[model samples]
Each structure stands twice: as structure tokens, then as C-alpha cells.
Target: MEVAQGLCGRGALVTGAGKGIGRAVAVALNRAGARVTALSQTKADLDSLEQECPGIQTLCVDLGDWEATEATLNTVGAVYLLVNNAAVALLQPFLEVTKEAFDRSFDVNLRAALHVSQIVARQMIARGVPGAIVNVSSQASQRALQDHTVYCATKCALDMLTKTMALELGPHQIRVNSVNPTVVMTDMGRLNWTEPQKVAAMTSRIPLGKFAEVDDVVNSILFLLSNQSAMTTGAMLPVDGGFLAC
Candidate 1:
């Protein structure tokens, strides 16, 4: 996936960069010449990523710890781009959902995004640098899935969070938006979607008759983060294979 020019040397931060979509985005940003800081709870993953992208910076933090996450991000310099891609999916039926599962999911998915964005945005305001933030929401946010009650709720809340951020941060020229993808073929996706019955159930509903690959979602993120979508903010860009259209 290719990103726009003029991003070189600009500071960018991506959370949950240890694996899946977040890892891909961090690498893409680095290749696009942005000075990237990749944050995740996994140190080994960070080490591997740093080796792959020699100049990339990586930070290890458990985003569930609100104070620690806040403190850790405060150490970073001004960020021109931020991707709140860290999330946890606690798959439980609606009636079986527990308070612990709900709290943990929200803390990681929604609350952490708010904290990181607040810090990054304040820095941008202080430095007077325009910034862009992309939150990785999901298709489940719009549609109710059988066992994704908590995950869906968090994403739905995240979409609203993105909009409110766009409304408030617009004056500062800091754009915020969400990229909602259908089942992505990441490792996690494969584990969850590879079963014949499950695959058929989902892909049948998608006009393209397929689940999304990591690159499909990555390309959409590049557009939203780059100047190509300069006028886009508070918009939900679906990287699904027209899955929502069904």
C-alpha cells in the first residue's frame, strides 16, 4: 500500500503496532517516510518491528493502565498523525457478557484512544501543527453480530468518539476519522473466520464475496491519513468488500 508524499520526516504515532492491522500501518507509515513511534504491550513484537524498520521508535505500554498510558504518551514529541488501532474483542453472547469483559474492552478500545489522542492533539495545538488521527473501528459496530456484543458496543462508541473529536478538533485543524473494515484476513481474522460455515455466513453477505486482506484496510488508512482525503473528517470509511451494502 502507498501513502501520499509530503509526509516525510513528520512525526506519527501508531498504537497496537505489535501485530495485525496496527503493525502493517506502522510499517507503512515508516516506509512513507514518516517518523513513526509504534506502541504496544509486546516488547518482542516491538523489537522485531524496530529491526525491520531501523529508524522506527517503539514503546511498550499496557493501554489498560490509564495513568501509565497517559504518562507514556506524554513523553513523545508532537505527532502529525495518530492511529488508535489497539483493541480487544471479548466474544460473549449478549446475555453472557460480564462487567469485567465490558470494562476491559472499553478501556482498551475506546478510553485509550481518547487518552492518546488528547495528548497528541494538545501537542499539536501547542506546536500549531495540523494532525490526522484514524481510529480502526469495525463493521460489527453498525450490525449486531451473534457473539460480539461487547466488541460491537465499543466500536459504536468509538465511531461517536471519532465524530466528537472531529467536531472539537476541527478548529485546530486536527482531523479525526474511523476506518471500519469487515472481517480482515489477519492472523486473528483467520482464526475467527476460516471455518467453512463461518466464512460462508459472512462472505455470502458481502457483495464481493470475500473477507478483506490487511492491505485493503491499509490502503484505506493511507488515504484517510494523507492529504488525498483533506476534506474528510468524522467520516466512516468502510474498507469492507461492500459488506455493509448487503
Candidate 2:
């Protein structure tokens, strides 16, 4: 009996890879023997990541712009693994949510994912290759959170989009799935969940009574991107410590 290989010699593209879970996923994929390309809007972050993890190719692109993102991806080599992790969270009360904020969130969170996935999937189809895609979604996509009106909406839409992509791409042997996470203790997460009262309020709802680490989500992304989840698609795997189960 032969064991299955995991991501060795494959080409991977991770969006929003300059920070937090995205950065961790890119490094993990590289460690697993994939040729990795990390894409982000911040050049400084990309440079720092490239320095820390030698051999990781970096690209700077504002994913919100479809034209720029498409053009940039066209210049890169074919991608077998893609992580649509780029997102912007503009927190506002439902009544206070501005049109600008809504449009901006959807532009990067939903539109950019579609634009990038189409490009990658087209390349995969043309080359007659099997591939995988993981969309970095959120528990908020299923459950409502305070002041997360826009973010939740975008994620819900993304989940639906994931389903549609899986449906269409299945014939081409392309698997598409999403990983939904609760509050992860990244710099942004620490900043948002700092107040003890707020932290307690949120954690009390989780059966595990804790927040997620960046690696918690990153490991799940790796599993979906790797051959281990070959038959899985259109599924929303939660790294939310029972938050969604509650």
C-alpha cells in the first residue's frame, strides 16, 4: 500500500499572506514542499515575510481591483492550490453602516475572491489539472455577531459562492471548500477582543470556552488544500471551538 503525497512539488498561491492566518498558511504550505506565492496589498509585509521564509515568492496586489488582480495573476505561473484569504472587516452597527463600507467590504471579500478563483480555475482547466481552493470564511457567516453586519453578509455570500464553485468545478476535478473560524488571536483579534467584558461575552458562548489560535485555522486550510480532503467540496469546516455548534 502506498501513502498519498501531501502538496509536494505543487504550486500554491495564498492571498492576504502578509499577516495572521494567511502568513502562517503560506509558510506551512512551503514547509510541506509546495512552491508558494504569497500575495498581499502591503509591500512591507510581503518583504518581511519573504525574508523570514526564504523561497516564498511574493506579489503585491490590491485584490479589490479585479483588473489589477487578474493582470497580476496572469503574469504568475499556474496555480494548483489557492487560498482566498484576503478580506476587509469594516465594523459598524447595522444602522450606522455606510454604503462606502459595504461596497468596500464586498469588493475585497467577495468580488476579489471570484475574480482570482476564476483566473486560477481557468488555468487549471486548460492544463487539465486537478486542484483545490480554500476560502477563508468565518463563523459569523452562519451566526450573527454584534457590529458584524457587513462582514457576516460578505462571508455568507462567500459560502454560497463556494457551493456554486464546487458545483461547477467538480466536473473538472477542482475541489472548492471554505473554513469558517471564530475569533482568532491574531494582532487584529487581540485588539478586537481585548476588553475582558467583551471577551467573556464571546467566549461564554463557545463550548470550548476559548478563542482560536492562527494555527488552528491554518492547519484546517492545509488539510483541505492537501490530497487528504480529495472528495470534500462545498463544505464549511469550522475552527470555531464549538461556537457554531452552540
Q: Point out the worst 10-residue segment of candidate 1 by lDDT.
A: 1-10
How many residue-pair clashes does candidate 1 contain?
A: 0
Off by over 4 Å in 2: 1-4
- TM-score (C-alpha) between model 2 and the true structure: 0.97
**Candidates' C-alpha lDDT:** 0.92, 0.93
TM-score of each: 0.97, 0.97
How big is the positional error of residue 151 in model 2, measured in Å on the Cα after superposition?
Answer: 0.6
Residue 121, candidate 1: C-alpha displacement in angstroms: 0.5
lDDT by residue for model 1 over 138-221, one digit each (tens)? 998899899999999999999999999999999999999999999999998898776898789888899999889999988888
Clashes of each: 0, 0
Put down candidate 2 lDDT per residue, 59-140, tens digits, no spaces: 9999988888988999888799999999999999999999999999999999999999999999999999999999999999
Report the number of the highest-lDDT candidate.
2
Task: Give lDDT for model 2.
Answer: 0.93
